[model samples]
Target chain A: MYELTKVIKDYHRGREVVHALAGVDLDITDGEWLAIQGPTGHGKSTLLQMLGGLDRPTSGSVVLEGKDLAGLRESEITAIRANAIGFIFQTFNLIPTLSAQENVEAALVPLGVSTADRRAMAASALEGVGLGDRLRHLPSQLSGGQQQRVAIARALVKEPMVLLADEPTGNLDEETRDDLMALLEDLWRELRLTMVIVTHDSAVARRAQRIAVMRAGKLAIKQDTRPAPAA
Target chain B: MFATYLRRELRRRSRQVVLIALGLALGVGLVITVTAASTGVKNAQAAVLHSLYGVGTDITVTQAPAAGTGGPGGFGFGLNRGTRTRPAPGTKFTSDRLNPGQLAPLADSAVTKIARLNGVAAATGSLTLTDVSISGTIPSFGGSAGASGGSASGGTPGSGGRGFITPNVFGVAGVNLTQGAIGPLSSGKITAGRTFTSADASANVAVVDANYAAQHKLKVGSTVAIGGSTGKSTSFTVIGLVSTASGSGSDVYIPLLRAQQLSGLTGKVNTIYVAAASATEIGGVSKQISTVLPKATVTTASSLAGQVTGSLASAASLANSLGRWLAIAVLVAAFALAVLLTISAVSRRVREFGTLKALGWRSRRVVGQVMGESLLVGLIGGIVGIGLGLVGASLVNAFTQPLTAAVGPTTGSATPGGSRVFGGAGQFGGSPGAGPGSAFRRLASSQTVTVHLTADVTATVIIAAVLLAILGGLIAGGFGSWRAARLRPAAALAKIA
Candidate 1:
């Protein structure tokens, strides 16, 4: 579970200091599907990065399972990400030189995993994403949807406690987007991975267990789906 | 892992490695060949000189002309002890006179050994003859002597242009020869009948140089008669002939006492040969001889060895010159290789380096990686160069004639010394280094004579080559570090191709 409490993220360029995230606060229980909806520059991605411990908040607290993410050193934060945080970027940042399976294996190589175990786990993760036959295909050979699926498989390979995705369907066609949405819904039900999706899509927002709306670098509202549906 | 990496690098860069090897091989091979050829000259010189002149005959007490009597060319020996000093040119009685009895005092000192210096197979001192007209006829015919001192005009072929026997101002070796007791000639090089026996000293015999024998058309057992101022001297039979064609002319060699007796230069044979205990003892022998014969300077075998290897001296004189050129060439190659590797590394890594730094990879790690790459290249290059040089040295050695002019016809003997020209697989051997007969003799003490690509020379060259490679590696690594340290982490990582 991650609790973000009034975190401000600032960026300074030359003489200007812009507040990307200003006093945002939110909390979500474990195993829940959460969606953050915001326009560009509204601190949606910054909030996700803070929650994932990949970026530090300029002020205030990003607490994950009672650990203060902002207080950790860079290496400690890296270790936390590698162990418990999984990121699904909008662009599917897979290493181009490696095949889907090899890309998954590269991350594990640095972790000192045995080759046999790495391949078996990677294969299983690919199968979970219905990409068992495309394990050997390189990112260049994959379509946008398939490459995103490979990224999903990579994110799932380590079995992290949470998956954080930024604009997951932002680059896909309408048909592939619907299929991916269904797959994610099914995975969410079957594996029960606590995941947060940051997107502008009202449709994707509608599918989540909870919705958090951000505006002007602050979270303006959060609605619980079960109670809000009755309203 | 390193070996595997090396094998991969070599395989991947096979063409480049081969090119490097060939270049290095050619350079190494030439060094070996030239060094060997110079060594040959030394060996040939040593062998010939030793056989012609005994190794330890100290102080060749030739009569020095009174100061400032030099003609053009300085007569090449600083003075002409050969020409008459007291009388007219070619006078019958103005040959040098010295007390051979001066040798007696030497026998009492550390100079326990002594031998009268002479250049012939045998000598006879025959009952102390006052004078010997011992002449060979011009034959009233048209045959030339060995042509040693002959003029281009042919001298009218024994005509008044000139008609005379090859002259002889003799010495005392005839006693050794007539008695058949000739010493080792480069260890058992006998090309004629037996040397004379001790009884032959009483047998009234003579032995001569092969050059003289051939010149006069004389053969073994031939009787040679001569007239002397004392009386008609004994007619002696030719018993043996020395087997060197080195210098020309007919000079009859007689036994030691006989030659002294014949020249009336008896009690005046100022020179004697004494073998040093060993090559290491040459200096000591020289010192011992100096002490014994205080009036004369004792020349060591080293000095004479130098005299032998004239060609080797010339070659070695080129050492600094050739070494400097080789150093320049090697340095240029190393610099070019360093620049190539460093430039390539920098060019290829511009974007990657930026990415790594942005990803939180530290500056020190980036520097370390770059240096590692450079070190890898240098190590590979050095090993390749050495292998090529070794092969090249072998090829060169095969074609080389290993002798030196300085190493021939030495006049002094070190112990365990066998004198011959530096023609026999010549090597720099023993202590005191058998000096050259000329200026290099002074350098002998400081000069370490390297072998001619024998086991010894091979070792020296290898050490030098490896050291050069280490130097190259340091350059590569240091330059890489310098280059890497100057890069801006943000800009370096930001470049995208």
Candidate 2:
């Protein structure tokens, strides 16, 4: 679950300041497939980073589970990130030095898992992504789609409270993107995972339960186009 | 954890680690070798001094000339002529020096009571001159430790050839016997038919050194022709010969009245020998004796020893000071090189470390892993340095003689014959024969020596050298990783270029 109350962020150098995020108010619920769509430099990544506690906000509060992120110490925030959060980057950021299985296992290092158990869990996560045989392959050795698949396995392995993927298939081909969308949907249905994926693709947006458009660092109204027959 | 960080750091920068170790090793090794060689030199000098001056021969009492100025010490003007193995009150540092006669009581009434005091050893008398010789019934009392030309490396006659000898003679006052019986009729105590008894105080008899006897080829029962300061000549029978070295023996032993007759002085003795019972009592007794003879200075053996030791200590201190600073400077340079190289290597792995950090690894643990490897590098460096030092010390000593030569605050000229008191080889490098180049070459060659390095001394060397090497390596790793941890993931990603 993610919640923010009037979040603002900025960066400064010498005598100049750049307001990356002017004011943003947004909220998302559990198991909600929400898409925050925006053009480049509209505070999309900044918002994601603030929500993930990777960056601090200059003003206002970003809350999760009724606790303000600003109030947590860096170490406490690190613990939260270790146990509750998982991220997917645009480039499929797997450690180059580690094998595919170890890339997944890297996430478990903070969880205080034993090495043997972590390796086992990583293997299981890879199998879930349907690349169990490619455990020993490096990120450089894997195709873009397969690399993203390994990224997804690493994210899912932690069984986190939320999956925050910035650009999961941004680098994939159209066909690969389509396949990734299907895989994501199957995983969402099977695991009932609460995932917030930011994307500019209409096809990807159509699969989400709700799509919230962002304009100039502020959230616009959410559009829920799922079939109304259930109501 | 710190060790682990060090270890990782060392593993990561193996080349830098090895280089730093080497720099430190060379620095420490040089210091050790030089220090040992210098120490050896000081010991040898002290040995030679012991033989010349005897066990406690710190001060010598010579009478002021009947007229004419010598120096402020009433001994002589030449720095090479006085008895200053120890520094006088005015000296900057201690060394083998003979203080001037300014500190002494020239009058005889001043010292008579001191001889009777407790702890007083036999107070013998002696005479020294800038130029003088003896030829009486001189015993062949040649001392082997003197300028025997034996300690020389080549074992051949030096270019200087056979040394010339002067034949001027003088009579002397006799001291009562204490230590040993004479073994021959030499200038030293006679171990023969007889010493002139008080009954025969005026008897025309004489003794001589064995070497002196050999020089003039005189045997016991033979007669010798002697000369005086005033061209006085007298022939006396060689009644006995003493077994002392060449310098320690005397040419003639007659009653004080007879000496007055031969030297053309009514009843004047030129020198006095002041001996105390034990070494400890010498200091106090010497001071008390000086009070009576306000014109003559009195000194103990220890003061002379201190003067010699202090001069060497000064040299050592100077050398060590420069060495310590040099070691630190070199170590600093090594550290900087290591740190820069390590940072360069670790910078390439920034993202990897960030990933590790994001995985909840503590910064300290990472630092430890990096630093652990540095200590291993330091150990290797220390071993190399110690080995080098040993090799240097041994090689230097083996080719050359021990560096321990007579070092002193005193500039007084020493007689070669007096060096026999050390009972070992006399002082090396003291004669005019060995020049600086020869000394230097000797040091470069085999300077092998028997140095008893006690545990404490060894400990001091190791602690000083090894600690320096280890500290140098660890600083290199610590500087690199701390910078990587502060990067924000987004900024870090952006700054990866």
Candidate 3:
């Protein structure tokens, strides 16, 4: 679960202060697929960063699983990121020097995972994404779709409770984008992860159980596509 | 994980690592070679200077003859109290010589007083004589009895017109105990037979120099006639032969009492060799010797070691000075190059490190990664440097001659507290053999002695070089670590998308 209260993020571009997320208030439920959709410079990525604990809000609180990230130490926040949440970027940010399997294993490095367990887990995660045969292939050698699959494998290897993705299909062809989206949808369905994706694609927003439309650094609307269960 | 990361990074950047390591190795090699050579010179100087005074002798006290009274005699040698002073300059004694007086103020009593001084562990006297004549014809000088004084043109063969034995035959008195009983001519300096003994004092026994005996065809146990400046000649048996080729080639040696009686200069000595209670007391003993005899010039081992030898001294000095500067320049350049390379490599990897940080690597961990990589480079560089240094040192040793010039002989009155006042005199008279227009007075001799210098790489130098290599790496690594620690993961990871 995640909650943001009156969050304001200001950026300094030379002399002027630009408000990226001004007085934003939102909530995310556990195991829900939520999509934040907006045009460029509308704080879609900023909100995702706050939810993932990758960046702090300039003011106010970002709470995940009832823990206020603002009150946590930097190291504690990192442990939360490493153990409880995973991030996937639009460009599929894999270290160019490492192979697909190694990129997946990297997420577990900070957890002090044993090499044998990390290797076995990494191999299983890649196979789950249908990349078992391409484990040793570097990101440069992989197709856009395959690279995104590797990114998906890396994000899921830690078995985090939440997955934050910023423009997951923004850089791929339409066909590859559809395939990556299907893979992400399958992973979310299979793992029951609380998936938060920031994207402008209408097709991507259509798959989310809830869609929050952002405008002018604020969440202008929230559309519920799926009915809530007992809770 | 850190080790894995470091190994991967190093493997990916092997080229850059090798380049920086080579530069550092070159710098370290030059430092080693230059330092080694300097040490070699110091070692050679120590050996030669110790041998200058005689075995175990630390100081020499010589009464400097007043300038202008004596010409810097043949062989580029400084004149000692070789001959008795005449009443007037250039006034040849119609008789063979005049009675000795005034000049040699050092006496047996002075030796006793010096021995009593603090820090004076042992003191001994040696008498140097010149211009005495030998009756036998030395065949090398055309086999003429008076040939020693002939022309004053030629000295020993191959002497290059210098270091000629003076016209008057030269004789030495008293065992030069300044070097202790081991004798100045230790080892094989005494080539044949045995040295003189106390029993030989009244006996007409002499130990001739190797060169002098060779020229005159004199052998051990052969009797030869020797005449002093006093116009009195005696027949002495040649008991031994020693080499004076590397030193002032004084021709003969006799007992102190015998040489004193022969020269008519009694109760006086020309040179005194003093041994300090400890090496630390040499300076004190030197000061005391000056106090006892103000006119005396004291030369210590250290002071004499400071005197540079020939053109090679300049060469060694140039190597010492220029080598140091060159090494420093190379080290600075290498450091700059290594730093630049490390910075470039680190800057290029900002996004990768940021990603790691975002994945929960602490700033210290990032810094450790950078430092670890650089330290690996440094270790390799140090190993390479050691190899290069050894090769460089060996090459220098191959091309350069390890030799130091032996410090030439010093002459003065030495009286180890005893009754023997070692004294001798030379001819102050002119003879037909004295040659035309040449001063009949005996001349001092000079010869060049060479001592070997062996360049050695000391353990201390090796350790220092290794440490320097590591420091160089750490310095370069520090710069990289600083840059790495300053990287913000949010800003850096944002750069990727």
Candidate 4:
């Protein structure tokens, strides 16, 4: 579903240029659950942003379905993200003013979805995550586990081709984290989406079919735990 | 989508929106109020000018006097002597004017010629009797009814003896016969009897000012002997009585052709009041008239109003010019303040904007949202400001009196009791008994001069103000939108601050 060819990303901080991603090459099969795991500053988040089209690579290219993302215009990249990719932030990143349902519907806004259709899709997505009863509750009113469930519903509402999660369970308790991981796995299987989760936890990485470990702006290791399916 | 985003944003940050709106409103209000007040003053000045030069006469043409003409030994040195000996043009006299011949400009033929010119609605000639002297029984100051010619010109009267009061006479051709052309005769000033008309032009008729008639114990149909510049006395029947207010020049009105004949300067006129076909054509007509009479100095309503030589002129200038600029300064400050408020409000939402970007919202969409909210704020502020401005203008108008000045046809020096043809009340702020403060506050408490406000909030002005407000808001939001567009979604999501 996605491929990165020698992807390099540099950040300008005052008088210094920090390379967040350097010469990264990776590939993911269709409908596979992949996890990129690394320490705090090892470019895990940067690679996920480039793959989701939230940020562009400084050099090289990221390709989805044979189309190079680096060669497209900014608007074209945003269109691809709106239609094919969804992101779940570590902080849950729900607009504090919006209710849970509204937060879910927000993902469909850039896709030019009708209000009624968006509402219907958002309701179904929330029901799938067992948050249908908490549709009108704001993020501040929701529990940590429930807020993470809302974020998952928001990511699922769009029915994107790829679901990207950046440290999804970072702010949750151990029990809530485990529940959210199991919910994510269920969504991955039911929606048949290519899921890419960037995290520092080995336990979260172990649930994925394949794990790529990044260290010092480089892909250090790749481990496959699932058997290959028949063609 | 933009509307929904805007609605939520405004609802969430309504306090900031109100703050910015109020700032803009204050600026727009001040400008509107001041501008309206200034317009009111200009309207009042136009009214005064209309009364001063006769209604409908937008321009006046006067011939400049010959160089080296008026001095101690020149023309009009001490013409108050009421002498019978006509002063020569170049006479080395102490105080005598160049008799009628030197002062007259347009001929009877010129009046007809200029009237035929394009853009000229009407043209009329006037002959002013500047040095005419009349020897009549001047009722002492209090209407005691004294004998005629009891005291000669410049002579001191004996105890209890009444002195002579020389009344100047004005002869006009095309004046509004019923109302008359000048003060004490123009509408509302006539107390009794009726004014003369064009039909009485050839009749030996006269309209005696109420003030002059009261002093002389004269009435309608009474005959008065008017001494001419050629030292001849002619008897004229007082056809009507006219009561004049202070500063109204002259006390008698007669026919222009008779005045010309009386001054022995037949076929000549000293002043010409020209009316253009329309207000917009005044300029072109003035220029055309000037070309026709190159030696004449032409004055227009706008040009006369623009002069700030006296207290009244200064007040008008304040209302017309200084006040407008002051309002603009306030408006600019208000816009700047609004911009700052909007920038602060928008900047605080940087994280939310980043979230939107991550959700695939384009940069233009973000810009549109910011701009939409700003325009809404500006619109609300503009409406509030307009209301405040109108109220302010009304309050100012209520407290301030319409400024007035003494203006006349020629813009020339006024002569006491002389035929001040086309002279309105208080010319040059030196009306016979005017005080020093007369220039600024010339109207009496009993009199009311309506100052109509010109700041009526025209559609064009409203549109322009709204456009300016929108532009200001866009400029302020531009900074925030740029910052939002440059935001890195990954960094923004991780920001805990």
Candidate 5:
């Protein structure tokens, strides 16, 4: 599902250049779950953003299904993000004015789904996340765990091929975080979704099929947790 | 989705919406009130002008009196002085004369020439004359049976005389019998009987003003004796009673031919009233008439509007200058405030907008949402503003007083001496105690008309005001949308709030 080689990302912070992603590359197969672990400001989120086509690399190529996301036009990149990729933020950035069902429906809006179909799909997605009863509740009215469930429902409503999560359970308690991780693992295995999760918790990283440790803007090591498929 | 999002967002910021709407409402309301007032003042001026300048008359042509020819030429009593045959003291003498005072007469052919000029639709001539009657008893001189007299041209009182003099004065206008659409009587409405007809061109007929008729206790078909320039009285049948607005116009109206014959200035007229075929051709026609009659003073309506004075003129100036500028200033401030507040609201919604963008919403869609919200606010403001504007206009019409407009010479020096035909008594050989009547006082060349000002809010003005409000909304929305459109989703989502 993805092939990246020698990707580099830079940022300008008041006349000083910060190499957020320096000469890093990795490849992942279809339906694979990969977790990137790093300290704060160590380019883990930056690399995740590049893989999701949310940010452009300064140099090198990030290939997704034989197309370089780094070299694609702005409109083409936007379409790819709309149709193929879903994002989950630590803050669960739900529109304050929209309800849980509406927030999930917003993901389907870009796909031009009819209103009735969009409502049905959003409700089903929320139910799958165990949020069927919170469909009409605003984000402010829901607890942190419920809000994250809503965010997860919003991300998976459009059935994107790839799901990129940046510290999805960072703002939740330990119990809620463990439950959210279990739910994410179940969804990944059931739907065969290519999931890339960035987290600082070693326990969250241990659940992935493979783990890559990013240090000082470079990928330092990669470890495979599951045995080779009995070949 | 658009409507839901917009409604929710507006509800969240209801206070800001109301504030912007009130600002816009104040601006629009003031604009409507000022515009209505300006229209009212303009209408009042037109009414005054119509009364003095005559209806449908686009231009007037008159000649200034020659340097020495404007005065009341000698009365010519021709009394013999220091003669034994002279009349004894205590004898009574009476004299009455009708003549064009302080006005130079143009040849009757001048009117014909002007009528034939290019761009001239119609032309008619009029003679404005004053009839003065003086009667007094001969004074008794001490130790003398007969009085010594030179030519009694000035009506000077004899030394040591005990007699008194009385003077009666009134205005008369000679109107064209065939052309009644372009003269003084054109503005008058016939209240009784009928106006002059073609057959009455040479007949001894007269039309009396309603106010003048009421004062003299006269009616239609009554006989009024008018003294001519020859000091001979001719009894004219009063055929009509005409009422003029604001009690303006001559006391009596007679056929032009009869007035010419009676005044003994045959084939001469003091005033020429001309009408143009179209309003747009008034200036050209005035120029043509001036060329045709070089010595005549050609005055157009626009030029006459500049000469108007009094409270009505002041109101017009205020409404046009200060009121207009103030409305514009307030409207501009409102627009600026709306724009600033809308931009601030958009800035506060950066995270929300970024989330939508990440959901694959295009930049245009985000900008459109912001514009829709701003435009809705503007529409609300426009509706409220219209209501407030109508109420303001009503208040203006209810409380405004009747405005008076004076049109003529603005200064005493600019006033032609001949225009003062109805001067104070004793200044023109009249009694010191006797003065002109109220009707004659209003007949002065300088005219003042009292008109009740009305603020008429027409449909066109309302439509334009609405369009202006919409435009204000568009402008504010445009700026806010531009700011929204420039936001990059990646950078916007990275914001803390």
Candidate 6:
């Protein structure tokens, strides 16, 4: 469902140019899970942003389902992001003022879902992430692992075609990290979602079907786990 | 979801919201107080002008008295007749005469001519007169009759055998019975009996002012003998008693034709009061009248307003200058404060906006959320400000002292012209106590009338004040929303905290 060819992204810090993504080429089939592992300041997050249509590549084309995302207008990219791609940040990034249910409902807001239907879907999604009893609790009241679960529920509530997570378990304890990974794997298989996760933890990266390691703005190596297909 | 998010956000920043609202309230309250005070000052000035320049009269036309025409028209006691000999000492004599002070008479036909002019709604002529009566015993000058030179002065008995001269003086106005709505008597309210009718045009009847009637113990139906320039006293019946609002009307009101005949200025009037068809036409009408009668001094209400002086005028200046500027400064400061605080609040919510954008909410949606929060705060401020304004207006009315206004030179004198007898023997020169100096001094001399200032807070003013507050809020909110709309999701989320 995704293709990348010579994706090169650059950033200017005052006068110096830093290359974020350099001549990268990759592809993934529909409903496949891919993980990118890299050191800090490498191209992992930059590549994820490009795939999610959050940012454009400086010199390359990113094709998702036969449409070139790099060439689309900003508004068109926003529409695609709303209808197809869901994002999960390392910090959970839930609106601090809103409750868990309201945060989950925010994902469907741009989809023009009615308030009543949005609330029902948000509740069901939160329940699917084992957070049905915490719908009314604010982000400040929830633990780190619970907040991550609410973020996951928010991402999947709109039933998007792709789920992109950037270090989702980076802030959680080891046990909570394992539990979050297990929940993500289960959702990926059950919904057949094409998932791409950017992470530094080797243990978390090992759960995906394939792992791509990036170094110094280049994809240096790729290792396939060859996991069984979903039943 | 929008409502929920906005409600929670405002609740989170409730303290800042209250602070901004209070700032707007203080500004709006000052605006209302200053505006009300200005209106009150204007009302007081109008009342004073109405008192001096008859009600409904927009312009007054008068001519400066020619060379030496305004003095006492001779007492006609045969002082100037060479055929009559001096009277014997202690011989009782009485004389009374009515003369027009300081203003030259305009022909009565001028009123008709002016009334026919374009934009002239109505015109009526009036004769403002001074009635003077002298009654005393002629003194013996060194056991001989006093030398006569058109001067007759007497007082308490002294080394020169002087005798007392008692003088009674009062103001009289001849009002046109045909057009009573545009002259001096128009401002009076009849308290007893009735004013003049068309039948009284040639009748020897008069309307006495209430204060003058009260002082002289003269009521309706009392006989008052008024002397004419013909050297004959005409007994006129008091037909009515009228009271003026500013206590500034003539002591007696007589028919126009009778006053003209009695004053011996037949077919003439000293002042012409004119009303224009519309207020907007006053300047044009004044110009027209000036063109019609070039020698006539035409005074409009606006020009007369400039001549008003005293505490009321001071109040008007204060309300217009210092009060207005202070209100504007406070309102501007309030709006600036609100804008700064709103921007600061939006800056703190950068992460939340970034996350909303990532969730596929349009930039306008996020901006709209910020605007909604600010507009609600502004609405609260407007309501609170209105309440504060009402309280402030009431306090002004409660604590303010009654203001005084003095209308100057254009409307004759506040002090009536009268005969003054010197304390010497054989002094007999007429005191021409009416001229530009006397007329200006008399009218310019402060006729202090205590006017109770009222802050007229109308519904329109309140509505405008509220709208002003709301506009302040919209401006502040617009700045905040602009900041919010410019946030890029990628850059915003990069700053984790």
Going through the candidates in order, their DockQ values are 0.13, 0.25, 0.45, 0.52, 0.49, 0.57
Model 1, C-alpha of B223: deviation from truth (Å) = 17
Ranking by DockQ: 6, 4, 5, 3, 2, 1
In model 5, the runs with Cα more than 4 Å from the true position are A226-231, B71-89, B141-163, B223-225, B410-427, B430-445
Measured by TM-score, the strongest candidate is: 6
Model 6's TM-score against the true structure: 0.90
TM-score for model 3?
0.77
**Candidate 6 error regions (>4 Å):** A226-231, B76-86, B140-163, B223-225, B231-233, B409-428, B431-444
Model 5, TM vs. native? 0.89
Q: In terms of DockQ, which candidate is strongest? A: 6
Clashes of each: 82, 114, 17, 7, 0, 5
Model 4: residues with Cα > 4 Å off, grouped in runs: B64-105, B116-121, B129-200, B203-255, B258-265, B277-294, B308-312, B320-322, B406-464, B486-497
Write down the TM-score of every candidate: 0.51, 0.59, 0.77, 0.79, 0.89, 0.90
Q: After superposition, how far is residue B22 of candidate 1 from its true place, in Å?
A: 13
| Candidate 5: RMSD to truth | 4.5
The residue pairs in collision within model 4 are: B76-B96, B76-B97, B77-B95, B78-B95, B78-B96, B168-B417, B210-B242
lDDT of 4 by residue, A41-110 (tens): 7788888888888778899989999989889988888898878888888888887778898888888988
- The better candidate by DockQ, 1 or 3, is 3
Q: Could you give candidate 6's per-residue lDDT for residues B1-497 as a string of tens digits?
A: 87888888888999999999988988888888889888888888887777777788998888765543444444434343333466766776666777675567789889998999889999999988767666667676644333322333222222233435565667789989888888999878899999999999899999998988999999999978787875557998999999875557678999988999888888999789999999998999899889989988888888878877778889999999999999899899989999999999989988888888878888889889988888888888888888888898898799989888765533332221111111111123233432333221222244556688888777877898889888988999899999999887777776531
CA shift of A66, model 3, Å? 4.4
What TM-score results for chain B when candidate 5 is compared with the true chain B? 0.87
Better model by lDDT: candidate 1 vs candidate 2: 2
Off by over 4 Å in 2: A91-104, A130-156, A170-191, A198-208, A211-215, A221-231, B1-133, B136-325, B369-460, B495-497
Q: What order do candidates take by TM-score, descending?
A: 6, 5, 4, 3, 2, 1
Candidate that beats the other on DockQ, 1 or 4, i.e. the better one: 4
Q: Which 10 successive residues of model 2 chain A have the least lDDT summed?
A: A222-231
How far is A227's C-alpha from truth in model 4 (Å)? Answer: 2.7
lDDT of 3 at B312: 45
Worst 10 residues of 5 chain B by lDDT: B410-419
